[model samples]
Target: MFVRNGTSTLKKVLTCPPTFLDEAAPINEISKKYQDQPLDKAKLLDEYQQLLDAYAEAGVQVEQLTPQESMTNSVFARDFGGCVKEGYILGSFKEPLRYAEHAAYEEKMAELGIPKILEVKKGLFEGGDFAFLRENIIAVGIIERTNMEGFNELKAGLEPLGYQVYPVPADSRYLHLDMCFNLVDDNLAVAYEEGLPTEFKELLNKLEIEIIKVPEEAIFQHGCNLESLGQHRVLSLKQNKDVNNALREHGMEVIELDITETLKAGGGPHCMTFPLHRV
Candidate 1:
């Protein structure tokens, strides 16, 4: 089965081991800070294993894609594609460095026997920009990595499948919508209000979803990018103290993990995962 919504119980996911993640290039605003420092591959692998262990403990099945040495950013598996009720929507990339990663995801999907719902032929649309807010409602980002053309293409394909897709415009610096907005529960979301436009905020308000606003400082740390494990539980970065505390205060279980090595590459727990099956 495919994921019904973002906050639904995540039953299965896809990830790529950081076997070839070696450097932090100037890909985005966040990764630019670590351009001078060298990434520790050993530590990255260990941290990735910890994430895999967490998924196993949470009763979520995991499938791994064969890592390629040339595709360093493939560790951010969420950008490859997105899974829907019908099948998978293969993504297109804006950065030339990531263009080849598309074929890898297609091969993995075919190997897993997951059919393709849409291939996103027109414009750039990464999985990080797409999120299923509910069973039929989806919020996609119009940011540096994704454009209006991509949003329209996705809407045209999914609307026929009973999905309503909304475009959320955000600052290009934010990279993707998940960087500032992510659903943690059926009626709860974490967001960096300053980075989002008024229309998106109004949409959330119309849906009656409570927003846990993160501070501006936390935005660079990818604090809003968290994975919901269903049942009011979430996997977050250990350094996001304020967000974790806020989640705990809201009666949610927060499982913190040390992923400093991986963070140097401008991704968080949510970015490292691609949801496959959820209910």
Candidate 2:
């Protein structure tokens, strides 16, 4: 059952792999990189398994997704998209070549019994486009990966269930809401204000949300890719020293994963874990 109350209750979750064309087999019009300098198959497999292990160790349930033969090119597959209390909202890739990405997710969600399903077909929506700040409010970015239609679709699907969808206009530096945003807890978050619209900042202030600024270097390094493991706990793929310190000062545990090879293709811990339940 979905937890009605606390972040501490989010102990169970799900994650996908770095099934990008380079990490897995080349599918669709996936880059030539997979066919060119391939990542060591064994190492890639190990990395996926290690991610599984990390979740398992944290007491997070794991449901591994197998890649579709046609959507390997889509980066959405790499991060697994933003998930809500009901279940994972799988992305329908906006990129034409990545359009086939959604077809296979239904079967996986069925296997896991995730009740709700949201698909943005006409509008481009990647997983990185949304951020959950609190149970009622979420921040979504209008970027190349996430569009106005997709954002609207997400709100239509979620708001009826009592979730409030907030929009944050983004620039190129952060292609997705997640690139410069994430909720550490009910009251805390990190953001790159340069990309966050004034309207969104005003909304955050109205809600009494605390904004922790990520340094220019950290934002550039994708520091906003932080994922919450539990209350005051976090997991980051790259070890940005500044981000780590900021998190620590805020009383959050920052665990860094070795993702140099995995992230090169695009994505981090938040993209990997599609949390289905909060225990």
The numbered model that scores best in TM-score is 1
lDDT string for model 2 (1-279, tens) is 553322445566655554554553332122223445666545655667777777777777776666655665433343335566666666656555555656666667778777655666566677777766666677778865777887888889888888888877766545567767777667778777666788888888887878788765565466777777776777776466777788788888777777655544455666566566664
- For model 1, name the residue pairs that clash: none
User: TM-score, each model?
Assistant: 0.98, 0.84
Give lDDT for model 1.
0.89
Candidate 1 C-alpha lDDT tens digits along 49-142: 9999999999999999989987888989999778887899998998887877899989998999999989888888999999878889999999
Each prediction's Cα RMSD? 0.9, 3.8
User: Which portions of model 1 show Cα errors greater than 4 Å?
Assistant: none
TM-score of predicted structure 1 = 0.98
